[model samples]
Target: MKWQRFFLLGSVGLVSICILLSTVRNLVSINTNCPLSRVDKTTLQPTWPKNRVTSSNLSLNRDNKVHVIIFTRWKYGSTFTGEILNNNPDFTYFFEPIRREVYKNRKIHRGVFYQDLIPMLHNTLKCEFIDKNYTWWDEENKSLDCRYSKKLQNSILCEKSTIEKRDISAYLSKESRSRMVEEICRSVQHVAIKTVRVPDLKHLKSIVTDDSLNVKVIQLVRDPRGVYLSRKVTSDVCDMELSECDELKNNLNYWKDPPFWLKGRYMLLRYEDLADDPIEMVHIIYDFLGLPVPETVKSWLRINILKMSSSSKSAYSWRTKITYKTMVTVQRYCMDLLLMAGYKPVNSEKDLTNLKIPSIRKFSYPLMPNITFGVAKPNTV
Candidate 1:
């Protein structure tokens, strides 16, 4: 009986050894030559993909279950926007690319492997972006054949705002522009940029041309009154003709097809209506992106102003409530691009009057060339 017991103990010891070896193999660091490789297999990679400027882009295809890109504007309810989607372990929330410090190191999640991205995966999340100078689209494609060519085309994109006329040549560049394109296509399963302007359409098209990819563009249109009011309160703008709404319209219309990017791919969200019913707005947004409703999103239902002292669910409301000092600088930084994108300036009471928008504004739509602002904001009335 003693000998038999000894044999059984030996067998159990061997099995345990095998299990440990298998786990070590599975958890081995493969993608990055991170320092953790020598220390431990479980240590997180402190430096993200772009930290070292590694050009390795993750493959994005039908294999990816859910990837959402929020191409919106400031004060578009992105906090609640994040709350609506941030709960999902399958979805990732990238609030603002410019001020990425919602986490650590005060750096944006510049680049990452899609496979590594799972749901409920944000480290630190909030919205306090101070540099509107960060509005970088596709600056690498300098050839006029696409967008950055022709002085007239450049004029439309880099136009000075009537409020604060300034030259755009300083901020516009090729490197940052190129990076933006690669980040979108190569990301694991989500790319969201608040304050998407007109020239950015060119960048959108060049990067997202694949027919198989399910990319959705989300545009948040506040009452031109509110937008202008926000712009005025903050004194944010480039050198643009305040009354020249038609020039902005023409520029917006120009980019509608193969040459134009992200036209049919985007969905418009009104700021006021979103403030009224946050959950319903996000619910529809999830449907448009074809993502299952995340349970965490339920926490952000009725937030009017963004608050740093608030809960994580209010992430989408960052624009409504950010540092007062950052409010104007950020707005001024994005002013030129916003103006170029036909961001309507608030005029008469009729302009900022619509908040309860039309039904179609809630769902997804085809990327049409001449998109009419058809939604009726009844609640604002």
Candidate 2:
């Protein structure tokens, strides 16, 4: 009976040892692979592909996911318009992703700008940032600032201490941050990019032509007079030799002869129109994007744009605030483009200052040769 008891005790100890070993192995496995398990394996490319699959083509079909590009220039109310989509939970928005490169570097040449900037835009939109050319220097780390990108602020990475955080210094390696952002980009229902760097719509032909990317381009334009006034009062973001009128003319000419591919994919939204009726404009914007207007956006408009203080409204009332001399200068340079864009040039100081004398031609559509404003066709809007 003593020998039987000894054998049973020895067997129990052996079973206990096996269980401990199995637990140790499982813990090691979890520690080694848990973080990676969260990452989508398909996007774990050794290097970015020559042509990457856009976010729209990933888990969902192209029809279900849309990529909206807010293409505009400086002082054009791109920031305000971008917030419309940025506030939406469905969109993973990138605010002026190319600003540091374009504005800080001041590289706007057709050849060099297209070669350098377009690829960056494409890689970012497609959620691929692993290329050797995509390195960010110390100064360029401003792109990681949550102040610029509210979506980044909403991420788990952003801490409560500061609005700005450097990915290279504070959080993770560049590649790791890229992987995280790419993961976030892929998981979202839509991707939206607001850029003031794109001077000409024709430059985006490559991105727009990608059938896999359900691309909708909203070209936001403020009256060049308002743009000039804002630029004068505020410090200039960048010193560009090209005037606002020149850029406006360039875009208008491009709109006139937009390639067949651009027909249904493009939209021209006036800043005045949006400022006049934000909710209605948002609905039109949603209609253009083929999306149902989310209640969150309506709530945002109410809190932000609608309930804005009189003092704040006065700040944006450039039409009233700008002096007669300033108005004449802008109107002189931008007159043809202004008339084309449905803005009236004031003849005198009274007309410029008077709220009754309409500066913006209300209900007038932009002079687009092929398409109507706020209408979305099969390919472009």
Runs in model 1 lying further than 4 Å from the true structure:
1-61, 79-83, 98-199, 232-264, 302-381
Off by over 4 Å in 2: 1-61, 107-110, 135-140, 160-169, 233-242, 305-316, 364-381
Give a tens-digit lDDT track for model 2, residues 1-381.
999999999999999999999999999766654321111225421111112233422332356687889988877778778888888888888877776676557745656776678877877777776543554322245446577556677675454435654343355666666666777777778898988877677788899888768787888877777677677654332233236677777786656567677665677888777766565566667655767667677667656643333323543477677777666766776777877676777888866667777776665332232343433212211
lDDT of each: 0.38, 0.66
TM-score of 1: 0.39
On residues 256-332, what C-alpha lDDT tens digit does candidate 1 reach at each position?
23233443345555554455444445545664554545443443332222332242223223234444344343344
Best model per TM-score: 2
lDDT of 2: 0.66
Q: Give me the overall lDDT of model 1.
A: 0.38
